[model samples]
Target: MYGFIWRHLPGNPWVKALISVVLVLAAVYVLFQYVFPWAEPLLPFNDVTVNDQ
Candidate 1:
């Protein structure tokens, strides 16, 4: 997958690297801004358990 992205990016090595970084940041931003918020309520990790003796 990474190799496919690297190949598809158009430019010299430096330009490709910059574009790759920008793309990664954009993906992360989208995940935090939309995907994670949408999925947060569906996750079960917020439930707490305790034992009393």
Candidate 2:
């Protein structure tokens, strides 16, 4: 798991940071890209509503 990787790659601080950042970004990308798209139709937005007069 993460502990094993952390122990084995203890000497590479840069690699650890890069991997952590990539993993965090990937999770965010997946949430916004896939999960948000699925709910897009359920939400609503109006650039010009009745009050726009």
Best by TM-score: 1
Worst 10 residues of 1 by lDDT: 44-53
Instruction: List, residue by residue over 1-53, the lDDT tens digit for candidate 1.
Output: 99999999999999999999999999999999999999999998889888896
lDDT of 2 by residue, 1-53 (tens): 97886667644889887887887899999999999899887778544457655
Q: Worst ten-residue run, lDDT, model 2?
A: 44-53
| lDDT (C-alpha, whole model) for all candidates | 0.96, 0.80
Q: In model 2, what lDDT does residue 13 have?
A: 84
TM-score of candidate 2 relative to the true fold: 0.51
- Measured with C-alpha atoms, the lDDT of residue 17 in candidate 2 is 77
